[model samples]
Target chain A: MLLQAHSPRGLGSLLLMCALGLYLALVASISLGPMDISFSDSMRALLPKQSFLPSELAPHIEVIIRQVRLPRTLLAIAIGAILALCGTVMQSLFRNPLADPGIIGVSAGASLGAALSIVLFGSLAQHYPEVLLFATVPVCAFIGGALTTVLVYRLGSGPNGTSVTMMLLAGVALSALAGAGLGLLNYYADDQALRDLSLWTMGSLAGASWPGLALAYASLLVLGVLFYRHAKSLNALLLGEAEARHLGVNVQSLKRFCILLTAAGVGICVALSGMIGFVGLIVPHLGRMLCGPNHQRLLPLAALLGALLLLLADMGARTLIAPLDMPVGIVTAILGAPFFIVLLIKQRGRIS
Target chain B: MSIAIQTHQLSVSIGSKQLLKPTSVALQSGQLTVLLGPNGAGKSTLLKAMIGELRASGKVEVFGQTQKSWRSERLARHLAVLPQSSELTFPFSVREVVELGALPLSVSKLQLDDIVDKNLALTDVSHLQLRPYPMLSGGEKQRVHFARVLTQLAQAGEQAILLLDEPTSALDLAHQHNTLKLAKLQAEQGACVVAVIHDLNLAAQYADRILLLERGNLVADGSPWEVLSERRIEAVYGYPITVMPHPRADYPLLVSA
Candidate 1:
């Protein structure tokens, strides 16, 4: 028996430990980079002007910490949390351990939407206002994510309930379709739009702006509260659909709520930071291992762990090659693909 | 006794083939009911329809209230069902799984813990409370779910309705009897308890009432002695069988002849 925690106190302590770890990672993320600023120097730059600490850091260093790294770090935290939160929700909904937004075509559909927005909107860029240009991609991406989720859900569910086999196959098919759509969009995109699309495919925090950061944080807040409240319902769902309904979980509405919010969450993440893969698939599994499968504890722990994992991945993407700046998506895939393979092997029974 | 479940012409059909022909029955509190039938005999279908899981046309009322009128959460307090098998692959501890039953109830934490503890003890799974659900034997997992449903019905008091679908199909011999004994005990406490059981002797011993079905129709409804007559059993099961008084007890004992 892997006796993880014997008491609520123990679990609370474990959550605290993960939070502490996340804090350290956040500090490290803001401190260490290609510019090579000291931890204390970055912290001083972040501290208020009224603080007693003397201002000895260079203006450029302060600018680097405040303008570049701080926004980037914040973006990573929000993106990672939303990704992990959405992943946990999708896995519970599908009842498949391996379901992740990136692996299951939700991210790909959102990417397709983003591509269409760029290519179509680019042609009339001069006519449209800057605000509309900024809003179109995320709105379109959200619609795309929601539509794909509904289509996959319809294909997978029947009178008996959800067929994991059908759901996964549908995901695979949608991913391929989305890929083809992207290829077509690439053919029509202008030079600037094409460059943006290619960078998005790679996934970087290089374009982290203030407005994007606000949107990401707002989504994290909304999704975090909404998802947390339904922790009990999600747990009942794991028992089976009828079992959940028996537990008073109005199963239909719960499924709809989960599908829509998770899609929107994924849409927001994909909009803010291009497809950061595997955080959702990996974080919940780790959370369950650490805290067992109680979503009440798992959701919060997953959010913290997700933020930590992505921040760490982003840190690696920046420093490993130093100045060359590897795409964070590539770094995450390198870390995630092996873990996914191990999970696949572990689930020796029906792959569905 | 009060009627705990009453169905009026409740029927279920697939695209073309009817799985359960229209049937009506009223089950009372203070009686342990067993739905018995052979393969494709609609025993499972009747149970599914009663719980509103299957799309069946007919009026099903519980505690004098129509199924459609009672809110799901409100109904949950009064009714809980144990599925034949759960598809839960998540690594939840046994206690956590049982605790999921109390989701719809507004009981205090102490009351919730008390309910879980009592049911875990009732199902004889108190020792396995900390064990992960997936690592357990199939029977153990079933008992854990049984405990969960029991916990949900705890606060329902006299209005509780418990439905078990082949709950002992996975249990050992000792556990099979133990599970029926628990269901009987629940019936004695005034809850309406129904179980789909295949073991004829076990049903004869524990069930206060028996419902025999064949090909989507109710073939027999009465005491086990009336429902499990040797000729009736032979005709339905397509096997020659003898029904004799048990050497140790007064109820019928079935033997293949």
Candidate 2:
């Protein structure tokens, strides 16, 4: 029965199906927008025209597709994937399903940095355009996210190294500190700066650009691949530190590697999308439900499902309210919160 | 293949508290060597030192090589340890848990499956293979952990060194015997087995030699008859114990004095 459950063909088929679904979802996402480009026109827009291209399918449409919407959609996918990957790594690192990138203050720290950029560096906004202004936010956010993670790790690690409980506590403390900093920034901001900071905190894909998408997606994919390769080692870690060491895993080194990878992944996602909540928490849980807990299967499945969910959420954010544009984070919270509650209720007996 | 595990003047101090005093002991190859002691006797500490899990003042040599000289993966390939408590955070299946034993072998999937199956059968946990490991009773979990250690031993072949710290604490009487019987069999097959046991009767039944520890010091080492004497058991455990000849074997059975 165990053999049947772990059949390579079965896993391969499931992965293939998920990959096909993601591809279909990506194409469908590209078909969606404020402009009503039909599926045929969208396909034609992607390729060279048989006849002379119409002015409607002009260079501007190409720019919108290639530069604007494509990057934004890709950012959604990358951010979603990175967030979910971080969730998986964090949960295993802490050995608790309750752990997520946000739990460790990475997102909150990044948000604080972005908030500070908006509030104190608001003058840069007039000097530079929207793209340049937004660029500074991610850079600052990355520094804040990475620094907070290092602090949490340092505080958590003992003489032997970090205990799971210590790490969890450190994360909570760091998150609270970040939240306090964010509150201070919010209180002192001018009206326009306050509005901009609020929007950034609420989270959106509107600021997604080619450079931003490139930075987010590239880091996420590389780290995600590295994580996927360490799936077996992660499984060894589930046995706890001593047993993992007995199994030839360098437990301390693996913990450090996981922390660095999770920090990078979470940092990039928060930088790109401005703290989209629940994707990191929910998607990995969903993956665990479907794939069981062998990370070899869980990591990739979680990445795909995460990307799909966020893409769908982004679509709803745009289409549900039309031109008004609800925040993508708000959309995810609305959809994800109830589902998370149900998961909690169902697993309440087992969870500590 | 002879397996000698020798701790040379080993000492462990944790934060100004001496957990294990400087002590030297040798466990001969192909013998069921039992470490007997009271609570806080540093039996577990000494075991950890032997496995290189804890940093110590002196050296542990596996066969003739210093433990530090052996790469961790290479050391794991030959040595298997069952810690006193294994707290699993994730709900891995019994099979997944057992498969970890073959990690040092870097076995192919087919070989890993075979090793897991055989070890599970040996530990009598084949029936529990599909069950969630964390959901099992303490005794059942201990059996599964034993299966994992056994799998590691089987993979390590003749050179395997099995180090178990109170492995039967959670088992029922029958299981306790069965588990020790499996250990004895492994030792007979030329693996060096060192087990920390509190039950003197079970130790008497299975062990080829016994080493008694008292307050982080080695107090006695000999055959069960030599170590399970009324005076020594009473002296170390601070309890009256009667040592009498077993009806079925040459070794002595220990009872309340």
Candidate 3:
């Protein structure tokens, strides 16, 4: 009988705390990199027009903050938000707390797509940088993600309505098939292409650019609004699919829309950052612990919490080994895996 | 008054097995209809078919409109169903879970609050509204779902169809009686309420009409006294039961003898 009320004030306070946490992480992310720009100077660099100050950071420090760290930070925010939102949606769609983006096979499909593109165009690897990644790779990944989703969806749905169990089993099978595809690609790839593919698989913000950042934000904005609008329907779905339909939700369309939307979101995320995991899987759960599992409150909170966690993880990636960047995925797995295990231990009673 | 739901030769089959045979029936508003049958007697299947949860042959109509003609949201406002079990495992509170039922309606925040609270009270879950749903006992969880369906139908204003499957399978004696009384009350308010229940005594006590099914066929349809005859109950259920008049109540009583 905890917090028997849905008080706006309680939600307002949680949002405030999350916002504060995000701000701190953002500042640390921008200012505490290898160069270690002063907080005030970094703040000034963040300003639209930087004027000379007595204690200004180095001339190139401005470029580092404005061009490099800023875009990477914002990209982290966008990708993290998208991943978390997609994760929450996947869990809701499956009606299970444990389901994540990978459960749908879209992430695997995207990885395969990236590897394929890298191998297909490896001959021009030395000369082709921007077109290879930003254009061809992302498009291929999106197409691949879309194809695999449609395949899984078709395999699961029938006149009896879409079967969650069937979809899950199909996803597992498809993920295994995609893994085999990746293994084959690895065998065939050239050395430079292999390196690129490996880097893509690890997931990073080192390749963050303005256009990609814009694309990520656009996906986040549209996906956020769409997911939030169906918050009530998603809550109804939690009861069970049959119960959901009785509550006026077109359960079939809801599932289809959710699968495709999340696929697009995950595809974009994989395109930009490769294989960032755990943010989506863990942040919604943390949000549910803060607020109840009402998607109205859960989705936005997940987005914010996702952004903050990824920002912190990305910061660790940048600074953990000095100038040599570790994959953001590694830090997330290291951080999230243990925290998730601890959470499971605490929730063992409820889980059982 | 008027027929609220009607099905014409509705049958369901999966592969070669008929889950529900060609069965025709009609249910009216202001009546509590109880479906009685043994295990795999197709009581649940008929309910699922009427609610459009299963792929059924033949035609079903609700409030004079073909079942397929109504949009999902429109039908939801006029119909609500409680399944045998829930797959919900999220950390939602009882109140939050009940609030999910009002998703189909465009009621004001004030009205929604009023509806949710009143249903919670009606279903005897008011005391547990703040409790986390997963922590509740099985009976308590069923009561919570009962309250949710009530909340869903709160704005339906009487001309609604509410189907409940094994609604009291988990409840104790007193709560079981209370739930049936609530279903009867909904029928009194002009809603067409149908329940798939295993207890013959409860069905005789609360239902205005009784439907008996066996092997996916409608075997009997009448008032409790007409349908609860000893020969029919023994034949359909393959068990010995004595039918007798209740000492004081007007309905027939059945005791497994």
Candidate 4:
């Protein structure tokens, strides 16, 4: 019985731990903000508060807590989850651990799209004058992400099938093209458009709103669940194609489904948040190290860890400079780059 | 009962190079058939063609149905194959890999686990269930794959056919015997087992019938004594060899000439 438990029990416990970790992280994210609100005050603000508040409680704090931090935190969680899920799927699709949403040129494409929107549409100053810059950026970002993915898929796939190497190389080529396009757009942009484009390129959750939050979070959850159901197929695919086929998996269909789901998830994430690098690459690897490579465990665990990592990074971005805020993307890169280096160093000896 | 597999004048070419010439073979139910050939003899190609992994110019019938006539998923429910080399990129446990074999069954986890456990125990790999597949030794991985193949065979109902491409290449002597014995047991249980074997001795020891291929052509097909004679082995394998009785069994064992 103990042996059987070791074989099966560990997986269940690990899943429970990931769930608990995600829940605690969510609570922490909702509680922490620039206002230094206590857990109780945060909870009170979260719920519909009646007339029992203190007289010194500013009306703006309620608005800030409800409208700003809540939506931002929720968006952070959703975007993080989507990035991690996409990373896991992409890694499997390419059969390379280095593969990520960025490797597929989605980030560059989205960035260029956002940059073009900034240059061509005269920034958020001209369009949606009432809304902040953050809210409008996601619209252009998503369109950019989707269009780039479609282009990359078409350019990379042959009549026979999509080659992982071809996709990676195509992504690199397109990324350079998009980067050049972005540079040209930046060179020609007005001062305000340039500033907005630069900040968008840097990535910030400051633009998160209730509508954007609802769309990103809902799609992330839905797609995350769908990818979770695909865990078994992904696991079978760890074996080569012939072996996977013998195991009764429809390899081509699974590949297409995984690719599309990954594209949609990553597209939404890039649209919502500029280019949050390494979360996709690092989170899935860490999850695999902790929970083994069973995607049933890896997917959910990676999602939780990615959300927690991003939320923590966002908190650092907000609090590190006191009143001034840095881009959350910079914070993730600062943290994730070193960790990625260490991972590479550790894997250096084993990689053949 | 219907024939499990029938290949009629099957021919395969890869980039102007003929890998397998026009050949015809019929695999019947409840027999452990061995495909004997040296390296680069196109045995694997023929097996892949039968499994629809490669395009062939001839007709293939699976359980009395044309290969093209049966849907892929439906064909999967009746036939399973273990290719020559399969490397896992991820760290899936042995149990997880074996459970994948039940994918065709479309059964629940409980049912899949039951089948996986049964196959694991049958292949003597139950103890390695929780171990990562890549961490296992070469022979252990072979057994694990055998267990996976067995799980697929079990879930594939009656009239199921199995194609194996050198299933014991990485296995040691004991494991090789055990693996082939298990495949023989599967055959006795009414499944057709067609395996490509390099070791003529193992073929003579276990095969109900042997098909000899020489340079993409079927040179001979019959019982071990008829197909594995000294002259025939020398002529097909293009090597000097001697055929002698096995120490423990009456089957002919090939020795270096």
Candidate 5:
């Protein structure tokens, strides 16, 4: 008998369904904000065909939909997809279910980098603000993430190869170090810098701009294709490191490539969206549960699921308290923790 | 016959505790060599050293190239190893797990499937092809791994080196023989097959040559009839064991005296 749920055609259909749902979520997010734009009006504003209409007819509805909500919604999708994809890769890399960018200290490292930018370059940022915002935070965040990934990998790996137990423990220790560094930055920050740091740590897509949207989507596209190419190698990896080696995979190079790419992808996401928690942690499991752990299927599917989940979470953050938009990170944690608990319960006897 | 594996003064040590003493031997194709040893007798270590899975002193050459010199992917095409136990972290279907054996080979889709199918049937795991690997019993897992290594060797043609550590340890009576029989067939087909086994009877029945080890040293290496004498068995295994000629075959058979 065919494994019904795991069949490629079945999973393809599920992915198509999620893609449709994501379109619907995108429409809902654009129209459901505090603005008085109707759902039809939002849709028309989004379509290029309707862009020729009179300004009076659509009013500032164009501004509200195109300028305000569109970028934020797109950012949500891009960041969501990026986080989930990185999480899927990280989980496989560590061979542990609990590995996530945020939980494993990559996000915390990024946060520390961002915090340094706000505190150290605060005055310089005011003079040439574009340079600081585009250069300092993203570069430092990428470096921080790359360093932490290498550190964690080095700390966890032994003569027997990488130990999942050691990786998890290293993640915990690094996260703690990041937290203390963040606290120290907080102690020294000016009032405005402190606010920026807090907003970043909590994660918000409210800072979405056209350039940021372009970067996020570009990163997602590149990472998706690159990761897909490594799918078979990743499958062999699931058998065990030694077995993967016997299968002719250059395990060291594969690990290095994955770790570097993921760190860069995760660093960019964190730099743009702040430390959005749980999407990376939860989305991979959700994808694995629906499709099997086959990376070829799981990576793209996880990206779609992550995009859908983040868009929905962003929607909740926007409408949860009306005019005061809650942090999207909060929404993700609320949804993710319960799912994680169920996973833990199911895997209680098996976790090592 | 071409030599498939040659080890010169090869030895493994971890933190100054020697696991395998310096051992020199040449394993030729068309021979099923069984490594028989008691508990902690360094059989697995010696096998790992030969395969370059563990760092060892001296040299290991596969098909004239040093084990360390051949790129892993290139070496993999000519060599395959089945560790004592494979740690399957995911719930991969048995077919998927077996297909991993074809990772080093650039076979077409149909050819890979043919290879997978033939080896799966050969190991009697065709029925479990679609089952998740983690759910299989120990014997089934062992057989699946044997199939994987065999699949790897299938692509290597003749004169490939097949290193198996305890290939039949978890198998039932019939499966144990079936597994060793496959190894014997691989050797007869001109592959260099070296297997680490505990069952003296199984080794005696299947091995074209037997190498006995004790306390990190090679005690005896010869044909089953020559090396499996009562005196040698007692000295190596530290037990009173009687060796008798198999009633139906020319090989020796052992039973506790």
Candidate 6:
């Protein structure tokens, strides 16, 4: 007996531990930076318990912690949660562990949408200085993402219902189409627009702002609760679409709802942090290995693990080359790809 | 006996090819009906059509109500299907897999657990309850699915219909008999049990009634002694077979001649 499947009571303890670990990672991410703020100072700066605490240090710490690091840390948690939760749902919906939003062209579609907004609306931003550019990009991205998802789903479905293989093929074709659109936008861009496009595509927490942070967190909470309630249905889906139907799950509606919601969530995350890859793919597998394949336990744990990993990755990006921030996407890919490969090799015996 | 399922001119077709011809039949409660046919003979197609999984040309009713009229959730409570193979991607334990059968029910947690536990033991999979479904042997996996479908019908009352598609295809001799015995036991308890099976001997021994299909047509429907005759078996199956009485059992025994 592997004895690896934890009891419900054991899973509760594991969740509590992961929650504590996530909190510690959040604290560490806020405190340690190029400025070398002490852990206590970071906490104090975050929560101002004393009004008069060494005025010079207080103001410096306050500026760094509040204006810069605080928003970044919170955005990391929200985006990470969104990506991982969506990944869990996508994997179950598609009936493949390898599935992620990227597999279905949502990320590519969002990137195309963002590229369009940045290149097309560049002049508009200057003329309409009062208009917030943040709102425009995400709205456009959401539209693009939703359109691509609907297209893929339509192409994949025929008289026999949704075909996972057809969906994958359609996704690849759409990703290529979006890539062409991005290339065209790249060609039409000026130097500044080109630079911004590159940075956004590479992905960074450097763009984190208070408003963006608030939007990301709000989406996270709402989507998290909704996805959590659907955990059992997702589990039934793992038994295949027909089996799920036999078990009284509304297979067609569940597939439609999950796909659209994931598209929306991934669209917002891409708009806020750009194209961060592999966090969605990697964290859900880790959650499964830790807590078994029960989605009731898997989804929440995946969210926590995703948040912790991304926060740590962002921290490494911030400090590894101090004063020159690396794109957090690179860190996630570097960390995620190797772990994914090792898992593939380990499961190779059963691959057939 | 009350009719558990009644099909009026139900037929299935794909493109221009008719898989099952228009056929009318009534399956009664307190009986186990086994569907026997050669490959591509429309046995599975008719079973799927009866459960409304496939679109048929005519009507199917469960307990005097149209199959289409019942909500899927409510219908699921009265009818359970064990497909030939269930595609599972995750590592669900046998108990968890069994517990999924209670999804459509509004039963309390204790009642649900009792149903799952009872079905698990009924299928003789109680010892394997903690084992991962994917890790089980082919026969064990079949039994786990058997437990799942059985649990699904636990609350469906006397008029319930259970459809099994090749429920013993992967099982060994002992397990095959054990599974059919459980199906018969369900019928004895007043649930209408139907199975599509390939084994002639098993069908002869277990089925209260046998339905023999040949190339999209029902050629025979009667008791085992009436349907499993040597001449008809050879004609429908296109192979020579020997039919003899079992020495210690009250059923016919079949052997290839």
Best by DockQ: 1
Better of 1 and 5 by TM-score: 1
Clashing pairs in 4: none
Against the true structure, candidate 6 reaches a TM-score of 0.94
At residue B103, give the lDDT of candidate 3: 87
User: Which residues of candidate 6, in runs, are more than 4 Å off?
Assistant: A1-9, A48-58, A126-132, A147-176, A346-352
For candidate 1, write residues A69-146 as lDDT tens digits: 999999999899999999999999987788888887898898888778878987799998867877888888888888
lDDT of 2 by residue, B91-167 (tens): 56788888877777867888788888988898888998977676788888888998898777666766778888898
Q: Is model 3 an incorrect, acceptable, medium or high docking prediction?
A: medium
What TM-scores result for chain A when each predicted structure is judged separately against the true chain A?
0.94, 0.83, 0.85, 0.82, 0.92, 0.89
How much is the lDDT of residue B167 in candidate 4? 86
| C-alpha DockQ for predicted model 4 | 0.45
Q: TM-score of every model?
A: 0.96, 0.91, 0.92, 0.89, 0.94, 0.94
TM-score of chain B of each: 0.97, 0.94, 0.97, 0.95, 0.95, 0.97
Q: Report clash pairs, candidate 1.
A: none
Cα lDDT tens digits, model 6, A27-113, are 889987888888877877877555665545658788999999998999998898899998888788767676667767878898789
Best by lDDT: 1
Ranking of predictions according to DockQ: 1, 3, 6, 5, 2, 4
Candidate 6, residue A197: the lDDT equals 86
Interface RMSDs of the predictions, in order, are 2.1, 3.7, 2.5, 3.9, 2.8, 1.8
TM-score of 4: 0.89
Model 6 has a DockQ score of: 0.56
CAPRI quality band, candidate 5: medium
All candidates: CA RMSD (Å): 1.9, 3.3, 3.1, 3.7, 2.4, 2.5
* CA error at residue A186 for candidate 2, angstroms: 3.7
Name the better of 3 and 6 by TM-score: 6
The interface RMSD for candidate 5 is: 2.8
